[model samples]
Target: MAHDASGGEIVAAAGTTGGKKAGFFARIVIFIRQVIAELRKVVTPTRKELLKFTAVVLGFVVIMMALVYGLDYLFSWVTTVVFGVPS
Candidate 1:
């Protein structure tokens, strides 16, 4: 049993705890099977959906950049006022 960062209990899968270690090749096979299973679960977005998601992400990034720049400018101005401007 393992505790995650959030303190949730994580139980080990059956037959995996204190079992005889699988050989290197057997481990590789199991990894490949898990990879295939995960790949099958992936959903590819349609072209329109992809474009919309991209635009939204770009817009959000731009907005955040503007916000950070404004905050930095405000802090700089405040600092200049608190202390004499650099010569």
Candidate 2:
């Protein structure tokens, strides 16, 4: 662990030599290489699967909206009755 200027504990990099530091360009190149590797591993879904996922997400959102609206109406009704106001 390494401490910062404010004495907060900091985690050291794994697989590091414990003394050597990587240059800015070296770090950028490594980051780009890792991103390319990850992109190569990605498997895009088919159009039918994409449509199904979108429909499921939309249905979930609609259900959640209805649930929230129902709760809000119930709470408002209860509050109005408690406060002796017109509902």
Candidate 3:
């Protein structure tokens, strides 16, 4: 229904009538259909792409962990110096 800056058309869910609740089997079928539709839209990465993504994520996590550890250590040291060492 809408177009993005890149000129890609966006599909919007249409609201018709206030839809009646589906029965249990009907709901399951609807769910399976939706899942298959979503799966069809998925783009899987190649092995090289997956490796690069994994490296980037791991590097980010390690950097964040080191940053947090440094801050916590600094705070603990300051607290100990100000309040004296714990008994």
Model 1 residue 59 CA deviation (Å) reads: 1.0
Give RMSD to native, each candidate.
8.1, 9.6, 6.6
Score each candidate by Cα lDDT: 0.75, 0.75, 0.74
Candidate 2 C-alpha lDDT tens digits along 1-87: 454454433444867777656567866765676566667779999999999999999999999999999999999999888898754
TM-score between candidate 2 and the true structure: 0.74
Q: List the residue pairs that clash in candidate 1.
A: none
Model 2 whole-model lDDT (C-alpha atoms) = 0.75
- Model 1 per-residue lDDT at 23: 66
Across 1-87, the per-residue lDDT of candidate 1 in tens digits comes to: 454444433344657856556567866766676666667779999999999999999999999999999999999999999996889
Clash number for model 1?
0
Q: In model 2, which regions exceed 4 Å deviation?
A: 1-12
lDDT of 3 by residue, 1-87 (tens): 344444443333456445555567865765666566667779999999999999999999999999999999999999999999877
TM-score of each: 0.74, 0.74, 0.71
